[model samples]
Target: MKRVLVGIKRVVDYNVRVRVKPDGSGIALDGVKMSINPFDEIALEEALRIKERGAADEVVVASVGNADCQQQLRTALAMGADRALLVDTASAGGAPGGDLGLEPLTLARVLLALVQREQPFMVILGKQAIDDDNSQTGPMLAALWDRPQATFASKIELAGEKAIVTREVDQGLETLEVGLPAVFTTDLRLNEPRYVKLPDIMKAKRKPLDTLSLSSLGVSSRARVKAVRFEPPPQRQKGIRVKDAAELAAALKQKGLV
Candidate 1:
């Protein structure tokens, strides 16, 4: 039985209230809620489906976040992961400076230890994280592991120690065949994610989630970049309503955005 691993992250859920600031960092207003990122959920779904199809034996979900993230991991387990692992970023007094703010390369470095230990047949993840919107981690991990990787995968197939991955190219869908021990970063069209039933949620409580520290992984990085100011975007102007078709056409023509 081969082992499949998927990367998951707890982030400000996409549907939550999002206030994009002048510099683009979203502001969390009072009582704003956070949840597992949507893209990651899509990846998790694909992994679960692959498992259900018996393409692989077990689905192991792992994440790097604060303690609150464990709930999200449990949610992953509920969704059908055989087990979970949380690389604790807060227990050891947080990421030295704050937020770990680690670049994709830095994260790949940190995760390599876990990856080496797990030695999964395949690694799956979302094309990009909703919060950071950086699509670099999965590819970075593949490079670190010296394995083949396909990104933005919309469709995927596995057989005879190989994977046929389909992704949306600039013009249309493009397919590529890669050998096993490959990596995939899935897009939204890959598969539909499942919701946790009460029984599954309860069952998740019994699934094991191993925890580890960054120091244990021996990860070090220079704070190459840091966000300084947070400012909200300018409020939008009130809409200018048009009554007639001609009026609408004329308005569109005036804006030259038709």
Candidate 2:
């Protein structure tokens, strides 16, 4: 169907001030506001645009998490994804002892399974998730699928079976052309996601949202990395006021900075 598979990740809303749990187990997500990862939203926006331009036939959004993740998936559908898929990890034993958090490698494996099943021409994902900020999934998926990948793509254009991607780099923007059946990770410069209108939200409810289990995908949810603990950044030291540059220089000298 010349489909474009887009990955969505559920993360604490960027607006929320995250708190470390009392026990340092993890960030307190119990009552935190959750939403689709902003980068992933950008990725979906690009995919939707591609479809709107008639370059792709279908846009399927997918996510890996508990049932709560469906909320974000439905939100993607509302954002214009034609269909949504949720890899339900709630029932499939997660981590070493059932921790719901999945590592980047595990996520790559899950996506690879989906890639094999769907055989989509292209896969799109956020360059990184806000919560973890480990920008590893896209590359890992490409390696596992043995497909070309263009990461941190600020712009993309399709021509027949090839894609020209403009990547954001420290050295400046770099461009590359890759054939179809590749992977792309979106950067912030990508198009902003469209707002989900009320009518679309209602229509999304009726869109196909299929649920799959880890077993069905032949991918294990067990995490490869164990999170020892979460620790908050140390509080910044109080700033001292100096009356003059000389005083500031003195202070700097006292601190061995000069």
Which one wins on TM-score? Answer: 2
- lDDT string, candidate 1, 29-143, tens digits: 4466777778788888988888889888899888886788898999999999999998887755554434325667877876677778888888888888887687899889889
Candidate 1 deviant stretches above 4 angstroms: 20-26, 95-100, 234-236, 253-258
lDDT of 2 by residue, 115-221 (tens): 98898999999999998888999999999999999999999999888999999999999999999899999999978789999999999999999999988999866
- Summing lDDT over every window of 10 consecutive residues in candidate 2, give the lowest-scoring window: 92-101
Each model's C-alpha lDDT?
0.82, 0.91
As for model 1, its CA RMSD to the true structure in angstroms is 2.6
C-alpha RMSD between model 2 and the true structure: 2.1
| Candidate 1 overall lDDT versus native | 0.82
- Best candidate per lDDT, number? 2
Q: What is the lDDT of residue 138 in candidate 2?
A: 100
Task: Give me candidate 2's TM-score against the actual structure.
Answer: 0.92
| Candidate 1 to truth, TM | 0.90
TM-score of each: 0.90, 0.92
